[model samples]
Target: MGDEWRAGGFGLYIHWPFCEAKCPYCDFNSHVRDAIDEPRWRAAL
Candidate 1:
């Protein structure tokens, strides 16, 4: 088990919660938006 994660087992994720449309099978916490506050969102990230 030692150093197991070093073998390409880790990932980096950035969750942007806004989308133009919602897909039927996506299990993400997201929203459908016609517009977004981009500057505010960038600052939050």
Candidate 2:
């Protein structure tokens, strides 16, 4: 684990895709959800 940390280690990329409003030129893997199920979201992780 120490050696791995010295080199390129693992990562956790969490894409929180909730926004108040989307942009005009949005070209990313995201979403604009009105309401998010907090319990459901936690269960996924």
Candidate 3:
């Protein structure tokens, strides 16, 4: 046996996809004046 293996690692990325109601200092991949339905977004996750 070589180097021991540790537990599996996992990551979760959540995108807001909306920023039209706030300031304009954000540099992320956000959108503006876009309608986001919750049920439709849940299906995407």
Candidate 4:
């Protein structure tokens, strides 16, 4: 169990294609795209 954190390390990741409002509690990376293609986005990921 201890090896997992040691080997992989600790971190956080968030993926947001569109963020209309700002969140008070959260201080993470985010982006707001005016237009997004759902199919293309999924395929690229």
Candidate 5:
């Protein structure tokens, strides 16, 4: 596939699961919070 495709033409996909704020019009999974514990979250990750 790599040899068949053009050198500069490629696609990358990333899935993000966390959002601090939620939008009314969005159908994605999101949450709103007042504060975040970075160290704890990083450890969990």
Candidate 6:
């Protein structure tokens, strides 16, 4: 248990639900549109 990588058990994970490309394998949660209305989406959220 003397691994240098394991000395500090600190990690970070970020989840961004937005995608610019539409993947066939992915659900409709992500979209790839030419224009995105940030103000509308922000207000809806």
Clashing pairs in 5: none
| Whole-model lDDT values for every prediction | 0.89, 0.76, 0.66, 0.66, 0.64, 0.66
Report the Cα RMSD per candidate. 2.6, 3.5, 5.3, 4.8, 4.1, 7.0
Please give the TM-score that candidate 2 achieves against the real structure. 0.48
Q: For residues 1-45, what per-residue lDDT tens digits would candidate 5 score against the true structure?
A: 665457767776553445676767888665666666757877775
**Candidate 1, which segments miss by more than 4 Å at Cα?**
1-9
* Pairwise TM-score winner, candidates 1 and 6: 1
lDDT by residue for model 6 (1-45), tens: 356557776565554356788778986566567677878877776
**Model 2 accuracy (lDDT, Cα):** 0.76
Q: Write the per-residue lDDT of candidate 1 for residues 1-45, one digit (tens) a residue.
A: 567669977677999989889989989999998889989989988
Q: After superposition, how far is residue 42 of candidate 1 from its true place, in Å?
A: 0.9
Question: Which regions of candidate 3 are displaced past 4 Å?
Answer: 1-11
lDDT of 3 by residue, 1-45 (tens): 233333335445787777666556766777676666869878988
Q: What's the ranking of the predictions by TM-score, best on top?
A: 1, 2, 3, 6, 5, 4
- Count of residue pairs whose backbone atoms collide, per candidate: 0, 0, 0, 0, 0, 0
Q: lDDT at 7 for candidate 6? A: 70
Error of 2 at 15 (Å): 1.6
| Candidate 4 lDDT over residue span 1-45, tens digit each | 466677778666547555665677767675656676768867877
Better of 5 and 6 by TM-score: 6
lDDT of 1: 0.89
Residue 38, model 2, lDDT = 66
Question: Model 4 misses residue 31 by how many Å?
Answer: 1.4
TM-score of 6: 0.41
Residue-level lDDT of model 2, residues 1-45, one tens digit each, is 567756779566776676778888887767788898868887887
All candidates: TM-score:
0.69, 0.48, 0.46, 0.37, 0.38, 0.41
Model 1 TM-score, 2 decimals: 0.69
How many residue-pair clashes does candidate 5 contain?
A: 0
